[model samples]
Target chain A: MVSIQNLHKKFGKHTVLDGLELNIDDHGIIAVLGPNGSGKTTLIKSILGMVVPEKGSIHINGKPLKNNWEYRKEIDYLPQIANFPGNLTVIELLKMIKDLRGEAKREQELINFFGVNKFIDKKLTNLSGGMKQKVNLVLTFMFDSPLVILDEPTTGLDPVSILKLKELLHKEKASGKTILVTSHIMEFVESVSDRIVFLWEGKIYFNGSVEELKEKTNQRDFEHAIATLLTGEHV
Target chain B: MFKILKYSFFDLTRSSWSYIYFLFYLLLGIVLLFLNNDLSNAVITLMNVIIILVPLIGTIFGVMYFYNSREFTELLLAQPVKRTSIFLGQYLGVAVSLSLSLVLGLGIPFIAYGLFQSPAIWDFTMLLITGVFLTLIFSALAFNIALSSENKIKGFGYAILMWLLLAVVYDGVFLLSLVYFQEYPLDKFSLIATMLNPIDLSRILILLKLDISALLGYTGAVFKQFFGTSFGSVISLSVLVLWTILPLLNIARIVKKKDF
Candidate 1:
């Protein structure tokens, strides 16, 4: 589980995240939805300790992340676009991460479930956009770390690859790994997320299950429900 | 620190081309030795310049290599690795790699030439080691610039300025001071000023080996009194090591707190 309390992040005069509080429980796929620059990436980055918050703290599994960085071993992150050195073949990159993690079983399971075998020998830069995203997905799953934070995980994937990813994600969920994902692709969010966190204007507008969101908006689908909530004025 | 250094060594080994220029320099050293059958004073003077130039090349390319690898560096930072490890690892990697290449390129020939010329082997070896330390000092400065600057042009510009200062301008200014301070005992001042630049220190160490420390004019005598002893040389080298380490420490701090 993760807890974020009253988080405020600013870049110079621009406040990207302000007075934001949210909690995530164990073993659920939570999809964060927001418009551009609505602090989606900033929130994920803050959780991963890529960006420092101006005010407040984030706790992962009862322990606060510190400058010492021992907390990071429990987390895996997939940025919107994962880039590596052009010379790094998929196997080398994965091997390097595996070496860094120093884990055996977790690395084996993640690599197996993610189907990293297809492009294991391919250089990262030479892969197609979809394949590159798959490589990122594979690495994110590779360590089997307890908490996985993925920003736009399904972007650039073909329908088949997307389906394959959903299958793997559901299996991971059933096995009780906490996942926090952010995506603009509403359909995938609608299908996969157990809960939806609607962020608007640097604040959490709504936090509820997908069905609950639809029920509150009186809509049939999660997408239309979120659209109504995001466009409406009242919280 | 050891882990960081280990990872950095592997990273540099993967690139491989960074050492090519040093190999070229080594080949040049062998050719220089090949040309001088007698190992005359002229060859010795040219070798003096080569000693300084070896590390100069190391600093330039080492800075550029680290700068070029920024994307990989960013990715590495996001991991569980500590900032200090990352900083120290990369610094030591560049320092060690360049030092090895330089020694291979220059040391082998220097020794082979020494055997023929009857020059003091220990003295020459000491000078080579001093050159490597000097190279590491400037490489650290250049590495710090690359790490702190977002723009490559700005980082490179700062690197060039650093080289100009230590390698060229420092000597020019010292010569100017010598002209101005002709009447006074500027020996101590000259020694301190020369020591301020690692390049000058390296030059003096080499000159000291050739028994031409006197030709350094009055400052040479001052250096002879101050750093002439074996202990004095070790202290000066330690000071150079400190100079290399301190900026890298500051860089580690900045890199830790830096958002990217």
Candidate 2:
């Protein structure tokens, strides 16, 4: 579980997160929906302690997140970008991360599931964009952490790979893991997210089930509902 | 910390740039030794190269490494490791690897030249000590610059400008001030100015240890006139150590507050 309160963050004159609050106590897929610069990544980064909030307190499972890292042991993060150390081979990177965060024997399973074994020995820079994303997914899904934070996990993924990812997310959810996802694909968001937390202007605009969102917006289609939300038409 | 250090060290070692840097130093050392007949003069020449070149290399490598390893850094940042350890480990990785390349590159030729057997061993050791100190100091400064500036171009620009200021422009300004204030006794001014910059401190330290007063230009001459050899060496070494520590501490402080 995660809890956030009164978060305030500003970039120069632009305010990204202001007086925002969020809490998640469910073990299921949650999609963080927002327009550009809506503080979606900022929120995730703050929870991970990668970003320092100007004024806020984040608590992970009852403990303060400030100056605390032990909680991260239960959280696995998949960054938005698939950038990696180009000089490192996929295997070396996988091995290095495994070494850093205790041993994970399921790496091979994830590697094969993602079909990354073909180029596992190649340098990361040599891999294609989709391939790199696959590697990123493998790294994230390899560990069986209780919580996973994935930023734009659908980037550069093909239709087949996307289905595979969906299956993996389902597998994790079935096992009672709390997964956080952010993506622009309406179809993907509609198919996978159990709950949608819509962000507008650094504040949560909507937090409820898919049916609840459609009912609030008075829109028949899911995509049209999100469009209505972004247009500031629905409260 | 050690895990990060090991990966960073391993990553850097595989890069061809490291080998090129090592080979460049090795070539410089061998050429200097063979060309300069007098061993003491060779040591002094090595001092000059180490003074200007070490810091430049350190600054460039430090900035490059930080910006290059950004993805690697973000990956580590998300882990359960302490933030301080991440930066410190990477810092040590760069500094230690660079120092190793320096020691081995220069060491091979010098030791091959029987430098240990000659009476200039102390002078050579002083040169290497100052070399390592300069590397540690400038690299920390570079990491500090990179950590502060989010834009890579801006980070690189500031880092290189810093090297230019301390290594090249500072000397010109120091000389101009000495000339402008010729009527005044510049002993204290010159000593303090030299001590303030690690580049100047290192050069004077080696020159004083080598006892080559003639090569000790205006500022060095002023330093020699003011402090005894042992006294000046101790002070300069301590200041260099402080130089290394202060920037590193700044790095820790900045990272504690900085957003990814």
Candidate 3:
């Protein structure tokens, strides 16, 4: 379980995260939906301990998150901007990450499932955008870490690769691995997420199961439901 | 510590073929130092290059390496490893690579000259190796500033300022003071001033090695009397080591507390 308590973060005169609190447990995928500059990225980075908060604290798996890097070993993150050294090939990148984590075995089945094996030997810089995203997804799922955080995971992905990634996430979910994903794509979020979190103005406006959000907002579809909840429209 | 050292050497060795250009320049400098049978002029010319050019090259290389590896540093910081390990890895990597290049560039040719011409010249050649490490100390200081700044221009600007302060301004301040204190005893004070600049320290040590410390007149005599022996050799080496240690510790603190 991951818990954030009264977290506050500021950059000089402006506040990015304002006394925010959240709780997540081992479950199927939870999707955090927010517009740009809404502090979604800041929240994820804070969980990873990449950004220090001025107030409050976070705990993961019964341990304080700050400076407790042992908890990070259990979490795998796929950043929104996935970048790697251009000189390294896809296979070499996988190998390096595996070696760094000292993991004895990795799940390479995603590679074959996603059709990435055809160009696994090619340099990352030479691959197409969708192919690179596939590689990033494969690497993130390489270890069987309990908590996986993927930001904009489906961006630039072709239809087939996108379907394959959704299938992979489902399988990981079935294995009881907790997943937190942030994406602006409504349909993708609706298909995979069991719970939805809405962030507006650096605070959680809503948090509940997708069905509950639909019933509470009185909308026929998740897209219209989100629009009504965000802009407060009756139609 | 040992893991960092091992990986540091590996990182340097990975770029072996590419950095041969650095080796080439080093060899050229040494060959130019010993083209003549007369050792005095060659040593003087070599000292001039070591005192001035080596630090400049070191600063450029160090800054470029840190600036280029920014992403890798961010990735490393995200891992479970200790911040000190990351810093020591980077520092050792830069220091050892520069030191090896120095040895290959200047040490080999100096040794060959000592063997071919006269064995007694070996002491002076060893003194030259000491100066190479002094270059590493100054280079490490330049690297710290480059790594801490995210803006490339700002980082490079700070690095150049450090280079100028150690390489030129420190000496300029001392030389300007000489005119004002013409009557006072400034000989002992000059040695103290050189301590603030590694380039000046290299010049003083190399000058003393060539038995030309007397050229500075009364200051020369005082310097030689104070630091003319093998004990002086250790002090110079310690001063260089201090430069490496202090900057590395400072950089480690900044890196640990920094939000990447």
Best by lDDT: 2
TM-score of chain B of 1: 0.85
TM-score of chain A of 2: 0.98
Model 3: DockQ score? 0.49
Tens digits of per-residue lDDT, candidate 1, B1-260, equal 56657666676767666568567766766776677554444346545675557556656866787876666666666677776676677788877877777777677776677643565555556656776776677778877788778788888888888777777787788899899878998877886786677777666666666666556555556777766755556656766777777877777777766666
Clashing pairs for model 1 are B26-B105
User: Per-residue lDDT of A42-81 in model 1, one digit per residue for the tens?
Assistant: 9988887778787898998888865757778888888787
- When sorted by lDDT, best at the front, the candidate numbers are 2, 1, 3
User: Which sections of candidate 2 miss by over 4 Å?
Assistant: none
lDDT tens string, model 2, A111-199? 99999999999999899999999999988878799999999999999999999999999999999999999999999999999999999
Per-residue lDDT tens digits for candidate 3, residues B187-247, read 6687677666667666666666666655444444566678765666567667777767888
| Model 1, runs deviating above 4 Å | A106-115, A215-221, A228-232, B1-4, B14-16, B38-47, B50-55, B111-119, B181-188, B226-232
TM-score of each: 0.89, 0.97, 0.90
Of candidate 1 chain A, the 10-residue stretch with the lowest lDDT total is A104-113
Task: Please write out the lDDT profile of model 3 over residues A1-235, one tens digit for every residue.
Answer: 9999998888777788888899997588999887788788889888888888889999998799766666778888887866765666888777766766777255467787777899999988898878888887887887778999988999899887778889888998999999999998899999999999888777887899889989988988999899888786653
RMSD over all Cα atoms, model 3: 3.0
> Which lDDT value does model 2 have at B202?
93
Q: Give residue A2's error in model 2 in angstroms.
A: 0.4
